[model samples]
Target: QVFPAHGPGVKAPSLQDGQYVLQGVRALCLRANNTELVSGGSDGSLLCWDVTSGSLGRLVRTVQVWSN
Candidate 1:
């Protein structure tokens, strides 16, 4: 599940772009002092996101770890 960058105490504004949401998310991790986010999908797709400002996440790169 997606969550606000600052934590649960702070409420986040709604997002408009569909791309802002990561689908089929199985696992997620934060790095680089929370500036970078990586999400692993059930479809064997790994998505790298930029969460620098925490306003909205931007899709940085996508990698297919495995495919049928």
Candidate 2:
């Protein structure tokens, strides 16, 4: 999902170095004025990612949702 910083409608070069891959995520939510991304998925893990480089940045906070 790389896009031009100036023209977001335009596609840009990927930042991936091919040494790593991000996986198992769903329902993306963006915040921090579009600089930060957040999502939770089937792994029952919620994570916030860096939008600029598309890397797993920091472990912001976590929550447990008990399934009945």
What TM-scores do the predictions have? 0.43, 0.48
RMSD of each: 8.1, 9.8
lDDT of 2 by residue, 1-68 (tens): 64343342423222233233333444678995798888764334567888887888765544444545
lDDT of each: 0.55, 0.56
lDDT of 1 by residue, 1-68 (tens): 35555443323221333343433456789876777778665445556767865453545555666557
TM-score of 1: 0.43
Best model per TM-score = 2
Candidate 2: worst-modelled 10 consecutive residues by lDDT: 8-17
Native-to-model Cα distance after best TM-score fit, residue 4 in candidate 1, in Å: 12
